[model samples]
Every structure is written in structure tokens, then in C-alpha cells.
Target: MAGFIALLPLLASANAAAAEPGPLPAGWVAAWSAAAQAVPPAQDAPSFNRAPDTAGRTVRQVIYPTLSGASARIRLSNVFGNAPVTLRSLTLGLAGRESEVVPGTLKPLTFGGKTEVTIPAGSAVWSDAVAVPVQAGRPLALSFVAPTNAIATTWHKLASQVSYVSGPGDFSSDTQGAAFRGHITSYVWLDGLAVDAPGASAVVAIGDSITDGMRSTLNANRRWPDRFAALVSSSPAGARTAVVNVGISGNRLLNDSPCYGKALKTRFSADALDQPGVRDVIMLIGVNDINFGWMPPHSGLDCDVPHVRVQAADLIAGYQQMITSAHQRHLRIFGATVTPASLPADREAIRTEVNTWIRTSHAFDGVIDFDAALRDPGTPTRLLPRYDSGDHVHPSDAGYQRMAEAAFEVWSAPRAR
Candidate 1:
């Protein structure tokens, strides 16, 4: 009893152990870029949902990347809007699109003064973040109730993205099952962001092959940034980093490619800064520019175009310009070291030069070495044997894991500032 009393005296009281606020780390950043837009129903296609297609159209996945620096303030987009779009009601609930069905559990979202919004031709609107539980593998339903005379665009001729569709071939309207089968009714959504939330930030991940998880696992969603999301969610500190993957395959930083964000200067403001919940920029690109640049029928193709060789100086300038834009918004810019390529001797030489510049440059807020993280310990120039997805150019599922590990390590780590 005396020993217990002595221990009690030594024990620290909860009040006595009142916590102290240490130096605050940088805010968590989000990365979400609007890709497709939906419009009110038109006479030709009044009610649009993904329909069955023989050309193998299906709803692969629906991704909603969150942002940081603002809580409760969320924005949604179909940035690649081809025409007028309309959305009636929004919901965020268990997709139950294919595997399961949980009825009557749809959540509604809102904005300024109306639930129904009409986006003009070639434009988008941000959704006011409706509080909802958004997690991976959970698809969302953006319902449009009685959307009349609406014209919108989904993924069309988009061989790079794996989204569910209603039509055939195009990610547009034809999909695996009847469009009504996955019918989200245009009035409900599963989960939407809370952009108005205080203390939220977002990081836009811009790039080509690497950002898309080209060689990563199928149906596993093991992309590097996805893994980073898990890490951040589980971490006491990483709770702030909202990593968005804006990488489009075959995309170029300076030119419009089949699978890329536009060039460094043009896309900087759109893909990164324009995001609703954004505060930081983490870039992983340039490899495609090196390899695909040498190939024919490129994303930004032009017959008999100049056989110009894009040099390191050009890339450096692009990086400088992108960083400057982010800086203007008080956002931190982190340049990623370019990864290695399995291209011909000449192309490899160009890649080496670009990577060297990324590592050496002191211009970026920080450097994420995906090249160092995914390369073979032995060869140094190729993706690790196990990480290779058959093509020497892309990473295997494991390779994406390695990429995720590398990025998450930094994303989850305490901020340098």
C-alpha cells in the first residue's frame, strides 16, 4: 500500500500532462482534377448512364481524391467538359454498383443556392463539400434527376483511364451492363469532399505513365499515391496530405498527348492550382517526353512535324515555370526526380541528363526520388526485375508499390518547414 501511494505520487496526472502544441507542420494537401462533365438530358440522350457495350465498356472505378487547407469546402469537376452539363442531385454512399447493394443510403451534396447546376459549354463547377465518408474502392453516384436538354462528356477515346461507361468503346455512355443497372439516378452521391472544411490542403500529382500506375496491379488500386493516401490516413501526422494523381499516360508537359496533362506552363494553373482543395504540387513526369517523343503518332501528333529534340534545358525551363506559378499561390512545389527508361541508347542518354538536372537543382521546395526508389539496385537504369510489368518501360504492380512507398515516406513524414 505504501509502495502504491509512492507510485501514485510519481504518476503524472492528465491535467499535469496537459499537451503542448509543438511547431505546426505544413498543411495537408489534396490532389483532385476534374476529368469529365455531365449535362442535363438532351432529346437524343436525355437520361445517360453507362450501358452495355460489346467493345468491353465497363465501370472500372470512380475516384474522388480529397484536398487539404480547407475543411468542409469541396469542389467537383469534369474538367474535360466537351459541352453543356447539368447535375441535379449529388449523393455519396456505398457504390454497391456491382458487388453489393445497400439501398436508401445515399448522401446529398450542395453548393451556393441550388442543388441543380448547369455548367456552360466547356466549363465546370465545384461542389460545396457535403460531409461524407469517402474511402477507397467505394464508388460514388452523381445522380441527375430529370436532367433535360443536357449535353455532357465522360471518358471518350480515353484508352488511358478505366472508368465505368454506358456506351460501347468510348468511356462515354456504353459500359458492361445496362446503363440503368449502375443507374445512380442523377440525384444521389455516395461520398463527396468537404472543401469548406478548415485546415485542408491538397497536392496535385501531375505526370504520365508513372502517375497512372501503368505497371501497377490490376483492380488493386496500388498506385503510389493511393498507397500514400492510406499512409496519411493512418498516420497521426500525415492526416493532412491529400495526394491526387493527375497523371495521364502518353501525356506531355509541353504538348497535349494521349495520356498527359498539357505542358508545364499551361497545365500548372489548371491541374494544380485550380483544384478546390489544393496547397502543394508534387510532380512526376518527363519520362514519356523522352521516350514517346521519339515515337510516331504521339499524343500531340502532327505529320511531318519538326524532328526537334526536346533537351534538358527545355524541361528545366518548364519546371521553373510550374514552380513559379505554384509559388505565386503560396503553395510549395516539389519536383520529382525523373525515373529511368528502357529506351534505346540515345533516348536513355536524354533521360539520364534530365534526371541529373532534377536531382541537382535547388529550385524545388523538395525532391521526391521515385527514380531512386523504383530502380533496380543492380542495373540502376531499369525498373527492378520484379517490378517490371512485362514492358521494360512501365512498373509492375510491385513497382507501383515501391513508388508508393517512396512517395508516402515523404508525404507522411513531418514537413521540412
Candidate 2:
């Protein structure tokens, strides 16, 4: 039993490799994704010390999602890191709880057959595929030890899931969670996970906080994308389609946020077009561009953006650029009308204009009317009382479900010939 358990991953890898018969096939579909961004140490950073000098720690991140195949690989990014960082070791396994890996399910991960890997600044590397059968909608854990001090780390601040970090030591193979000394809400080092899904393709949801599931229950997989994933997994498309979320909490369509990284136009290629097996994109952005444009120049969020005022025209042009880029990659793009939000008159006008274009424009391959889905029937500019998450900007779990249903309708529609 012990020997068979240890050989499970190896055998799965051999079977997958034999089926593909060459370099890893292009059929790798993203099962999970968190767009990498630089989180300011002093603002919204996780409780743990995220500075580069914090090293010699073993971290275990639990990922809750299902993969499509028996063989899988992980992608680690240093896109926001200022210097190279060495990962001393890495491993993956089925999770038993918050930080514990199920005994005997843990498997070592390697890059080019080597245990140690140095990820250069502003880039990412995918580990060699391992035979780890992951069930759809299940949880998996990844453990790694950082041997050297890091000066700057690339991470996604709003993981919406709890991850664990341990005291100085290489605990990558530990099956128990007792050694995890602290907890972090954000995901570090990890960015994406892909699996050999044969005919499976993916739809990448590109947007801002609402798409990121800001007010939804944490670690519950209540994001609209998660809801969409559930819908896809049970539909006729279930066996062939997956939904991947690439949203950043404060992301904007026209301008860049310091914490969220580049503007949608600049990061679209990396976050959406470049993902494995991506056949479509559901873009729901622009509220930030409208809301932020109305804020005073001295507002802290204004410092990261240029002083120019953004208008609906500028935002539409940005969407046009994104559409062109997606088309260049032969990926279908679906524009999502921005959801309702209470804003000042000027910003509200811009939102109205942008949403109108998204509905009337023929530029997008298709349009998902998210605005119509969550808006209050009596007061069109505000979210439904039940759907509002209290901020009036984000949505409640009920609202996210509605948004998911709206998107599913468009996604499940018959493709035009």
C-alpha cells in the first residue's frame, strides 16, 4: 500500500505523457488563478511580514478548486518582485484541512527535474508536470520553503482563502498542520495551476473588486466566477469548459492602481490572453475608472494614477484596445456591462455611458448584461437592497449568484458559425 501510494503520481505522469506523446500539450487549462500584484507592505498587506528580508520560512497554501486531469502542474510568478528569489523546495498534495496535507498524497514538485528553482524578476515558471489526480471542485495544497531572504515578493493580496506559513525550517513534506505558526489570507509565489484536460477549454473573468468577490464569504468559493465554475461543471460544457478568475480588487480599465498593477489594457495579455487553453474572456471593468476619476486629486488612490480625468470615451477606447488584443490571440471576448453602483453625478454619467456602449456596441463577440442582473428595479442606479453588500460598490452572495447566472446564459448560448 505504501509503495503504491508513492507511485501514484509517477504512474499518472507516465500515462499523461504517453497520451500526449511530446512536449506538454497545449491543452493545459487553468483550474485556478489569482492575478499577481504588488501589495504595499503598509497598506492591505497580510498580517505576516511580507518584506523581502523575511526568509527561511516554509509556507503552505491551500487551493480550493477542482482540476480536470490526473496530471497537473503549477505556475509560480515573480512578476511583481524586484529581484530573483530562490524556491528551495516545493510540494503538492491533497489537503486535509487549513494547512495539513493528507498523509501519503504529498508529492515533490520540480522545475526541469531540479528541486530548487530561481525565478527571475518579472517572470514566471511552470513546474514539470506531476501525476497528481485532482478531482473537480476539490481542495489541493502546495507547500514550499524559501531558503534565501527575498527583497520583494510577488503575491495576490486578496486570496479569499486562508494559507499557512511556518517558522524557520523546511517543512515542505510535513503531513501535519501543527508546525504552521501563522496564517495569511493572501496567496504568495503561486499564481496559476493548469491540468491536462484534453478537450477542456477555459473562460477567463477579467475585472475589478466585484469580480474578485470583495464582500462575499471568504474561503467559501462564493465569487461570481466560482458560481460560474459550478454552473459550467454541471452543464453539457462541464467536461470541456472551466472558468478562471483573473480579477484584482482595485483594478481599473483605463488607469493603473499601485496595489493592483497595470491597467487592463496593459495586463490583458498576461492575465487573460496568455493563460493556457483560454478560449473566451468575460470582461467586467470600468467602475473604478469612473469612481476614481471623480475623487479629489489628493485622495491616496489618486497618487498611483495620472492627473488626467477619465471619461467614457477614454474607457471605450481602452476596451477597443483589449478587444483587438484578444482577437489577435484568436480568443473570443465578451464584454460585461458594469454593475450598478451609487456614485456622484459625474461618475454616474460616465458609468451610464460605458454600460450603454457595452450593451449597444457590436465590437465585442458578445455582451453579458451584468447591469441588468443586479440593479434595483425601482432605483436603476443602485444595487438591489438584497444584493448590495453594504458598500454599494460590491455585491452580496445573492448578487454574485445572479451575476453568475447572467454570465452562464451568455456562455451557454450556441456559438455563431
Candidate 3:
């Protein structure tokens, strides 16, 4: 009787402890990410016309996470905005058709325990972690209401996924989504979504339009990184790996464009190395650096301004710099051969020489032969007929899949930590 009475206090204490909320899971892995770019002027491209002010409107963006977790957080960027932007509210929910969300699954998100957060210009903010069940490959809709004075100047220019915007008020919490009357293909403000996925790490695929899935079917999630994530999920050795795409359309290896974001040499660290729980990098750039120099200057918004010609040696030096940076962070970086872009003889020679060096240099931790995967057997400088997306440069869905397969065959997930 005395022993039983003594154990009661200890048992009650344990039960009390169990009732209290525990800390969020430890490992934070980037489940979805898009490279942010300054909103180009209307003169740069017609798509910029769709870039909304977002003031007093609800912007709901859909993201397909590559990793699953019990809790998650989101990253909002004003990195290129000229002024600070205040958000009124934020919510996350499972996506339904068009702008609607799954009933009863919507959850509010707070920053530092507050409902509102002001992001200074040229910066980003992360929302506090919320207990939301996330599944790999499932789409999550993130909705945020902007203040009346907010002006959106930072966005992922080529989101390749359609997002929604509401009419004149805060519809961030609207599950029916009837108020979401506006549709945009760009992801404004929102850049990244990370989940507390323990034992999982991310691989960031960084490059230009090809890696950006420029011509892939909209809202279909058929990018090479998307396909790579699918492959990782099925492989027993990499079941816990996540793939993130940080490609920007028209991006270059050495030069920044007025329309495209910063050069990969400049943005590589911030976009890929600094990502949460990233362990590997796969880079496939240089095509633009070789081709942009030949584009004729136009009357307005000449994005390919410098037209600085680069040789195989110049491109090789850029790769060496990236390799050094990746090694400094103890990351395994893989070099991806620049895929066929149907270049002329001069540019084709540069591509061929650069690819040969990439395959032979042994400078990167490994190599991914994207060229071999999509190139025509007959005309080596052009894409295979079945793999071309009709735009000799970008790959079709099958080509993206083949690229993913090539990576998978050489991929080795980070060693257990």
C-alpha cells in the first residue's frame, strides 16, 4: 500500500508532462522553393502586367512540397521591393480546384506569435511553425492578405504554377475561395516552404530555363526536380530526400540581367547553399552565358545588354568557383552537362568543350550527364525529337523525366548524420 501511494505522484507528473505541447520536430528541410526575382517592368515582358500590387487583396499561392512532415513554416520575400510591405494575415490549407481549399483543413499562420508581420525591403521573413500535416507530392495553398499600402515588387517571375488573388478584401481565410477572382501564373512574395521533416535532406537543382521547366505543362508539376523528388520517394536509400528547384528563366552563369535575376555565380550561395537542410547541389547553367551574347539589342529593355562573349575557358572558371564554394560548405555538388540548345557552330563548340570538361575534369563531387539524356543521336547538337518541347531549348515532360533518371542513377543521398 505504501509503495503504490508513492508511485502515484510520479505517474501524475508524467501524465501532466505528456499533456503539454512538445517542441516542433528538429530537422527543417526545404520542401518547396522558388528563386526570387525583381518584378520586371512591363517593357521587359507582357507577363509582368499580371504582377499585381496585392494591396488589400488576398494572394493565394499553391506549392507542391517534396517532403512530408507533421509541421511546417513558410518564407515570404520582399527582397527586391522598394518599400516595406505589411501583411495582414496568413493561412495555409490543402488545395482544391482552382482557388478553393479542402474544408476544415485551413490553419492560420503567425510570425513571432503575431498575426501580422512587416517585411523590410530587400529582406525575407519566416512564419512561425504551425502544426499542419503535410504529405510529399500533395499541394498546399498558402494565402496572405496584404495591407492597403502594400506594393509587390519581388516575385518568382516564372512560377510555372497558377496562383490566385482575391477581390477587394481579406479573403485569406476563405475556404470557398469565391472571392478569388484574379488569377496569376507568378508566385508573388512567397519563395519557400520548409517542413520539420526529421532525417530528411534536400538537393537543390540550380540553373536556367531548362531546369526551370519553362515549357512543361502548367500546374502539372513535371519539372525535372519534381520528377527527381518522385524518384527519391520510391528509392529505399533516398526515401527521406527532398528535391528543390532554384532555376530562373534566362539566368546566366556570370552576368546579371535586368530581367533575369542575379547571375548564378553571385546568387548560388544564398539560393542553394543557404537553404534549410540542403546537402547536395546539381548545377546546369552556361547555355545562356554562351547564347545571350548573340541576341541583338532591342529598342526597349535590352536584357542581354553586355553581350559579353565567353569561351569554354571562361565557363570552366565559373564552374571552378562554384565547386570551391560548395566544398567550403561540406556539400556534395554535381556538375550537369549543358543540354543541347540547338546553337550555331560557334556556340555549339563552346557547349561541347564545356561539357567535355565537366565530364572529364573530376572537379565536382560527381557528374550528371543531362546532355546524353536528351541529345539527338543523329544531330548531337540538337534535342531528340521526342524530348523537345517544340522550343529547341527547353525539354518536354519526357525529357525532364529522363534528366531526373540520369540524376537518380548517379545520386547518393547524404550520409546519415
Candidate 4:
């Protein structure tokens, strides 16, 4: 009864292809299903092509990236739109490279097309599971002759975690077969994927914009989450846990609906919590609250204010609630201490209090001190000067690397996950 919300599995069918999911450990339970978060439309500035209800953006010749080694039975997102949307006149092909031609493959994707998908204005709908082999480091282009009438291009990258191309890469135009010639960054949905991923173990990164890896090199896809995933998947440290980022820019643990999160991509509960094989969650958000935007110090004071800031009790409660939610699924929830904030003294104080609370709280299964890793040795609460990403709020590429290293050192340890 206590704040319970039952999530129905993404609409799937018997014919949908599924991967042979590896077994869980002794104490593990499959609470959430593995599915990519986005049902993206067109990709531009990470925008969702939107129209009004009863309309959809029919991507002409689109290619979407798939989660590696995944099955074909997957869902799609129409999450960001002003109304219900539909994807039709479809053809599916294999991806060649960064951006190029779509390669014709033996495989193809389909749906109950006659029954158009009605993505509620505010929510997305998953397609009936289809069989598609998601290649590691490869993308699947979904081609169609139609267009969504009311197109609110979605944040395809947010969920799919793959890049799209205007044309196929490393392949010839003929390989694409039809109508696909140009190759720019792509934003389309691919099938043969699922949520509650088929993970041996999963890593859930929880945090703010930094963790969101905003402003990182575009199309380079070098966010620490991707790096961490690569690191965890290879060589000495390779553990079977899947890595999923649940960081919402400017998000606060206590503020479920913070203002910074209002404008950008966020699927916190569904992307991080509801993901399958997610045994661990690493939170790394907060900063804009402290920096307080251009108008430094509200009310003419020397400091800014976070109207939605979740101070002490609120933070504690938020952490406890998140952990409790994870526990119900028998998931192990790890608390990551807030990283250093590059704000003035008062803001730093608030961050320090929050970090301290995170460290001392018994509510988490474990605690990760990212603060210690990214802080300047000289100034414990400020992002290392060299790592600062211009704004003094975010991290540079090196800073992100430091952030990644710090987080990995803690969460990637044998003892933690």
C-alpha cells in the first residue's frame, strides 16, 4: 500500500525474439525487465519532433542503435511529444558506422502496423517485442517511406544509448538498398531490444548533469557511463553487470521533480529503477542548485537559492525512499556521495551537508565517496581546478574522466557490487 506503483511489462508477444538471459546470483531476483529507455524520433539538439495528438513523425529512412548482444523483441519510445504518434512505412537495416549508408541485412523488423501506437501526450509506448540482434557497437536503421504527421522529435539517445546517421557509414549507398543517401547524426527507434536487460549484473549511475555527461564531445559518446560500461565489460575488471545511467541534469535526490529536470530528458524511475539486472545504482547529481544560474544570489544576497533544494531531512528521506524501492526488488542500492560543487561558500556548505548525510546514512546498502575523488586536494569541496568545465559547475572531459575514475574506483570495486 505504501506508495506502490505497479508497472506492466512492455507490450510483448510470443513471437518476439528474446535473448538467453544469464542467471542471477544467489540472492538476486529479476524485479525489473531490461529495456532501453527511449523511443526516439528525430535527433537534433536532442529534440523530440512533436506535433499535436493524433499525429506522428514518420521517419523517412531512419537508423537507431541497439543495445549490444540483445534480442529482437523490444519496445520503442514516443515519450516526448504533444500527442499520440505513429511510425510507419518502415524498413529495417544494419548500421555501418558513425554515419553512412544503411546496410541490407537478412533480418527485418515489423509490428501490428494497422494498429497504430498511441503514445499518450506525456508517456511512451513499447512495441510488441520483435526479434533483432543488437550488435555491440553497431546500430540498426529503421527505414520508412512515411512520416509522422505531428512530429515532436524525441530524445532518442537518452534511451536507446546509440547514435543514428543520416546515411550509412563504412557501407555503400547500394547496401542501404533504397531511398537512404545522406548520413548525419540519426535519431530513430530500432527493435529487437528490451528493458530489465539480460544482465549478469547491472550498474545504475544516479546523479546530475555531470553524470548526464552533458556538453561532452557530441557523437563521441564519451560519457563516463559509456566508459564505465566499456571498462566493466573488458579485461581484468569485467563483471557481468549492465551499466545504465539514471542521471537527470540538475536533479536532487529529494526533489523528484526538480526544475532543471523539467526541460531535459529524464526517466529516473523507469530507466534506472525499473531496469532489469540492475543490482547497483550510483547517484551523481546537483550543482545548478548551488550555482543558481546567472543571477548569482537571489533576493540581492551574496548567495543563490535552490527553491527545490532537498536539505538534510529531505535528502535523507529521498535516499531512504529510493533504497527502499530498490530493496523490494531485492536490488542492492549503493549511495554515492555528492561530488564537489564549484559554487561559493554558502552553496558549498549545503553540498557538504548533503554529502555528509549520504555518508552517514544507514539507509543505503553501501556508500561511494565520489567527493573525495573529484575534489581539489587544496579545496575539498570544489571540483579540481583542472577538471572544471568552464562554468565552474560542470567538469571538462578530463574532469569527467576523473569523475568516472572516482566513481568506478568505488562502484567498480569487487567489494561494492
Highest lDDT against the true fold, candidate: 3
Candidate achieving higher TM-score, 1 or 2: 2
Against the true structure, what is each candidate's TM-score? 0.71, 0.90, 0.91, 0.70
How would you encode candidate 3's per-residue C-alpha lDDT over 149-170 as one tens digit per residue? 7567788878889999888888
Worst 10 residues of 3 by lDDT: 15-24
Best by TM-score: 3
lDDT of 4 at 342: 64
**Model 1 steric clash total:** 71
lDDT of each: 0.53, 0.82, 0.87, 0.49
Per-residue error for 249 in candidate 4, Å, reads 2.6
- Residue-level lDDT tens digits of model 4 in 1-417: 333322223334321222112232232322212222222223221223221121222233233322344344334454444665555444444655433334446243445433234444545444433345555345454443223355433432333233322232222223433333333232333222342344355577766667767666655646667666666656355444456555645454433331233321234566666554556776655455434443434332121234544345555555676777778878777777767766667767777887888788667777767778668899786778877776666677777776666666766577764
Clashes of 4: 61
Error of 2 at 254 (Å): 1.7
Which model is ahead, 2 or 4, in terms of lDDT? 2
Pairs in clash, predicted candidate 3: none
RMSD of 4: 8.9
By summed lDDT, which 10 consecutive residues of candidate 1 come out lowest? 183-192
Model 4 whole-model lDDT (C-alpha atoms): 0.49
Q: List the candidate 3 regions with Cα displacement exceeding 4 Å.
A: 1-26, 42-50, 412-417
